[model samples]
Target: MHRSTRDIRLAEALVETADTLVDGFEAVHYLPRVADHCVRLLAARAAGFMLIDEDGTVSLTASGTHREVALDLLRAQRGGGPCLDSYSSGRPVPPVSIGAARAAARWPEFTERALAHDIAGTFAVPLRRHERLLGALNVFVATLPPETASPDDAASDDGTELRLAQLIADCAALGLQNHTAYVQCRTLAGQLQQALSSRVRIEQAKGMLAERWNTPADHAFVALRQYARRHQLPLDRVAQAVIDRVADDAELRRGARGGDDGGRA
Candidate 1:
């Protein structure tokens, strides 16, 4: 397969995932989707997902989710896996072999268990958005050495696949960051609209009060606002009541006069 092309596709998929999060993406829901995409584009044989919570503990949100959820969660709890290192350090962890790792047992629990399950090597990469560490993506494979697998066979192409795996991790990070930004903007927009509407109703009430009391519009506005503040009532509700009583649209119109401070009750 075309490795570069596959990597590019993986990046695009990640960006799309990020976009969802922008509009308030859910971790439990989206992580599974990410796992699916990685399985399709990367040469990952089996994949899992994880995220770092506020308490500084990383939790597995989903596992081989597509294949072996049980083993995946076990690796995450044991906590010595490559993904943990990559996430804490904010760098990509290289693919690792079990036989070689026996010297030190990088992830004693994860290594032993995965090896028992017949996986020869594993790749763990982090998912980060901005400085926000989302979690890790873990993959298990059956072989490692190109020479040992088959000098001319497909397993020899693992180098290209490893590069693609890195790209996938990056894409996942970006997706998470993008989602956060989108949710923020949406929340801000809602607040702004509410503020604008409140302002409009308050102005309408001021005009009604001015017409009823036969005084300057600004003075009427000031009295209404002061009353609302004292009563712990919303300024808009007070304005609505004043308008209901007076119903004088002309007095409520804007551009009343210069230097008209509404606080001048």
Candidate 2:
């Protein structure tokens, strides 16, 4: 790709990845798409993502048909590689020539697997949200012969590839945060609805008990609490049972009367 064309394509890819933030895009679905963009715009053989979970274990979250590249990324978490190092240090791992002997020595298993897939160079950047580390993005580029120089070789273009990778990583991180916030909001909404529903049920059960036993609502509540404790049941569940007529109304009446007479249920 020509330098100007490559730059334009990179900008387009960044825009495309950024657009995902506006919708309900899942991290699993979107990160791989970004990886594909990285492969196309970075001229890499394949790309993948490794996510660090709450337990601090890293797992391969997304990849393409390049099974060898995917395997190398997974093994990287265990034995250590550019992706793992980048995620840990919150720094980009610049493109490293896979043909260099030092590369093989640095990441033995990853190098062996990568070389098997004809990958020539590898680059990685941390997926970070501000100061928080999320994961790392890995791009496996085709090897270039010494005679065929890369546009990134120019002093003016130094760190350009790494910067592109970081930009994509930033977009992925934002998508992840958006997804997480959405999930948490959904969970809290569900819990609130359930709580409201349970409260309604409890109130209905109390009214039913008060009418059945000819007792005040507060006395009915005391009866319900005592019966629930005696039966080793949840108060909400006992209330539900009462509302459902699963618990005997006669028994509840007796319990309420007894509780009013100093016998707690």
Candidate 3:
């Protein structure tokens, strides 16, 4: 791709990443797009995302392609790779030759799997929101460009790519955080609504009981409370039963009388 065209595409990709912060952001769908962006816009042959779930288990969340998915799953199952290391350390892992002795020693299983897939080198950047680490983005390099053939030159170029990857990962982390907050807020709102509905039902039940027993609303409420306590039922549930006429009026009256007698004693 021409440099100007690639720059335009890069900007578009960043915009798409930022768009995920809006409503209806699905991580399963968004993550694969992130992986695809890395491969298309960066020096990555393939890309994948690994995330640490609530149980602290690291797993392959998404990948740019099936082959990359398999490679990421292997890393997750066997438990040591650039992605895992980056996520655990909350830092970037610079490009490392997959065939290097140190790579083999540090991640023997991962190195073997990566080599079998014809990947030459790999790097990782942690996904973070402020100081909190969410996951890591892995990029597989099939070969180095001629301009970065020397170790020093390769390191310098890798540094630039690493920063770009971190930028993408930062956007992903923000999207994830926003989605979490949205879900939590929705849950809280639902709970409040349910509480309000339950309160309305309880008040209705109180009025019905007062009319039926020819007693004050407060005394009727005491009867409902005593009945619920004796039956080991939720107060809302009992109130709902009263509203539904499922509870026997005579039985409740007897129970209320028993409570009054006990209080007098």
TM-score of each: 0.75, 0.76, 0.77
Ranking by TM-score: 3, 2, 1
A best-first ranking of the candidates according to their lDDT comes to 3, 2, 1
Better of 1 and 2 by lDDT: 2
Strongest candidate by TM-score: 3
What ranges in model 3 sit over 4 Å off?
1-4, 15-26, 66-79, 99-106, 144-156, 257-265
Write the residue-wise lDDT of candidate 3 on 1-265 in tens digits.
4455556767887888877545676888888888887776665668888888768976665555655444553464355888778988999998888889344487877877777777888888998899888888888877766875543223347778888788888988887887788888888999999999988888899899989888877777777777887789988888899999999776566566443533310
What tens digits encode model 1's per-residue C-alpha lDDT throughout 132-202? 67777776666445554333223325566666666666776776666666777878999999888888888
Question: Which candidate gets the maximum lDDT versus the true structure?
Answer: 3
Give lDDT per model, in order.
Answer: 0.64, 0.75, 0.76
lDDT accuracy of residue 160 in candidate 2: 74
Model 2 TM-score relative to the real fold: 0.76
- The residue pairs in collision within model 2 are none
C-alpha-based local distance difference test score of model 1: 0.64
